[model samples]
Target: MAVAAGCVVATLTADPSWAVQRPDPRPAAQPAQLSAPARPSNSDLEVVRLDPDPAPPGGTTTVHAFVANLGPETTASPFTITVVLPKGVTAQGPFFPTDCADLGDGHVVRCTFGPGLKEGRSATALVPVLLSPDLQLGTLTGGSVSVFSPDDRNERNNRQSFDIRVVETAAG
Candidate 1:
């Protein structure tokens, strides 16, 4: 076929000193090709709200919960902070005296806030949760508040979800 089309047009018109360039040892602080973290979306993190948004079903609700460790880098040490309770709520403590840990797929009732939390360091947890006057008014969905760490070694820490809302208290 015409000597293979003139040897591919003389090797693509080679003239740049017999071209075969290869000297990009790459290292100008090379670090941009990391696409595997786009699967975690929670709009980042930082939520703490518990105002007078309805609290009277028997009384007692002083939720402070104000966590912040938005981490740009500097939050590695134990790392834990959980709060999942809202189905007739009931969790009052001095912080770290847990005993209702069974979320093995039976809905939810987990409450753990311990060991670590200090990146941007905005801690402020004063949970005195209680709302069980035979609970039957309305609105008490799934409530949640989590923050974990320890991802690969597998000791437990790879849980992050946030959402909490409670309303319905004025039928006394």
Candidate 2:
């Protein structure tokens, strides 16, 4: 190329800045890890509460505990549920919503839920529990069901348990 006197001519080259910036042909930022996700809320996984705080004895009753995924994205991963046995309260059988293992020796019931728990959604297992026929009518404390999750942002709300009371079955 020839430039006239007092005229300036610049050669063009393939430069990154000169290239068409069509919305950054790449993700804003790809996550490095696949297991745990970075979520905006502190509660990525949580176990909200347990139903039937006072369970009746001598009969099989359905008990449900709420597990929540408060993250920004839905995830497909199995989480563990552990129900700490209350004195005189024993599980009649394995929990419903299937695919659960009863760790008989531990006296603690464990259940696995979901390959995917949607964000802001809650799930639970309707566990069948039977109060011991001979259980003295009283409150059993420290009995809780907790959810152990992989990418839970906060661990505070992962467990919920209340005093379990064994009452006489109503004659109906």
Candidate 3:
């Protein structure tokens, strides 16, 4: 401290007329020039589609979907996956004991199940869909599956869709 003070005193004495002390000048930092962002390669964000289970005429198919956090982002909560019942099929009971229901699109149903989606985590749900007795004994096709991010409250994300197909049921 004494040596620093002595240095300051010597500097001030050398420039006695100066009222205020001046600090050494430093180089100013230039504003950073940001480069344009790279365009997406069409290879990013691949969404793994889900498929619905197939049911046969006069039979019941319990569809269990494997839901997973298949993204790099950490979901604050588990994602809600709704299985909308397709045509010729009927929902048996309450979807999940909560804010979800069967919209009964004949081939589509919506369900919301929970907690949250952590990275690399997965969950599953059972969908009991009863096929109509009148369905032809051939391969019944055209089914859909989907998942959303509604936190057990609302379903604002409906753009996501999954593909599902059902083959004909065999004779009992």
Candidate 4:
């Protein structure tokens, strides 16, 4: 503290031991380079639907939904298939994969297949469907099967429509 012209001034001086050390001017040493893991390859998936044999209006049938990898590479992630049935039709379980679930008013069914679907290999879901007893006898349209995957690159072959043919049960 100093006083000049009847005014007092206070100054501050940090001790050398209290001074912070300056960081190195050059960039710090980087960690050793590590190779990154290989990325999952893209795949092309195709969906096919096989309608069951004609059954009576009140009877049951199965829809065979098949998905194949038309890949230049094998899938490294899981994929899904969804079945949307027409009015008056419902999907029942004991489904293939055993994990298939009916969603939204019993008209839609979804099934999942895990990773490692090799190129040219395929998987299928057997969906049992029941027709309303009052459903008229004929072909029921508007039913579709679609596939989805984070790795599938082709959307053109991801979906297909199927028709359920209904016939009158023959008398014994």
Candidate 5:
């Protein structure tokens, strides 16, 4: 402390003849480029296309599914997944770890995962498909699936569509 004081005194006394300039405590006015920018947060959700399986007469077929989290953020809350079924296709049930419901309208099936999936993790589900009782050999179209979350970043991969053909078998 004494040495620092002596040095300060000497510096002041030596520069007495000239005016001493002190730096401004307040920051200098500068463009935004002078400051570093914050890093971008990643929150992405994706679902694979739902393919159809053969549901022959009185027999059931399973359609496998996959969901992936290719982001930097964790899904902090539960998120719902809706799989819109195509024509002539019905969701008998969804084999998933979470609570899944078949909306009975034959158009929508929903699944909710609580506490959500972590980043870089993936989940799978098996859906039981059957030919809508009245239809025989119809093309299934206009099918899609979406992951409902506010934090999703890449919308392109979030939803997908598929086409399927169901033919009536001898027993069907």
Candidate 6:
């Protein structure tokens, strides 16, 4: 027996002295047809939020943007994570990936991660944020974090909204 293209082939042989002089009534064997392997299925990438610590107006803080693959398959392509800050906050870089791009006048940032993220594995982006000096002391809403990839098909869990609470600084 021999294996070829995911198929098995068998061969048989007989001695001439033991064989009758008659035509064999079996049909000839045909070559096996080979098909291309199927492509991998889509992955599931989710944004696991890690909200920033409360900071006073004009103070700086870090936003932990955690992303995970709740995947049945590993990623087959690269993906990107975007962080959008609220009105009163802005991104101050020294970002985790070092290549994270600041966009929309510092209120938004985009970070990239290479493929091959296995199930339960995660990637994180640390974005330093600075609150405006004249901002009010309260929860700053409208901030968001989102993920995108050609290998991910679940759109529902790809994005999540966040809030940055601004508090008053205590003087020692």
Deviation in Å, model 4, residue 141 alpha carbon: 0.2
lDDT assessment of candidate 2: 0.68
TM-score of every candidate relative to the true structure: 0.27, 0.68, 0.50, 0.75, 0.62, 0.75
Give the alpha-carbon lDDT of every model.
0.48, 0.68, 0.51, 0.86, 0.68, 0.87
Candidate order, lDDT descending: 6, 4, 2, 5, 3, 1
Pull out the clashing pairs in model 6. Answer: none
**Candidate 2 weakest ten by summed lDDT:** 34-43
Q: Which ten residues in a row have the lowest lDDT in candidate 5?
A: 1-10
Clashing pairs in 2: 76-115
Runs in model 4 deviating more than 4 A are: 1-38
**Weakest ten-residue segment in model 4 by summed lDDT:** 29-38
TM-score between candidate 3 and the true structure: 0.50
Model 6 off-target regions past 4 Å?
Answer: 1-41
Best candidate according to lDDT: 6
Residues 1-172, model 6: lDDT tens digits: 3345456564544645567477779865555423432344579999987779999999999988889999889887788999999998889978989999998699989999988889889999999999999998999989889999888889899999888889999797
Can you write out model 2's per-residue Cα lDDT over 1-172, one digit (the tens) per residue?
A: 4445567665544665567566766666556655555443333777776556465556555567668788776754567778776776666565676766567743477888755677878888766777777777777676788988665767888888856767766778
At residue 77, what lDDT does model 3 achieve? 45
Report the C-alpha lDDT of model 4 over 61-150, residue by residue, as the tens digit.
988998999998999888999999988888888889899998868899999998899999999988899999998989999989999988
Clash count for candidate 5 is 0
Regions more than 4 Å wrong, model 1: 1-20, 24-52, 58-66, 70-80, 84-130, 135-168
Q: Lowest-lDDT window of 10 residues in candidate 1?
A: 35-44
| Clash count, candidate 2 | 1
Quality of model 4 by C-alpha lDDT: 0.86
Residue 49 in candidate 5 has what lDDT? 75
1 against 3, candidate with superior TM-score: 3
**On a 0 to 1 TM-score scale, where does candidate 1 land against the true structure?**
0.27
What's the C-alpha lDDT at position 9 in model 4?
Answer: 67
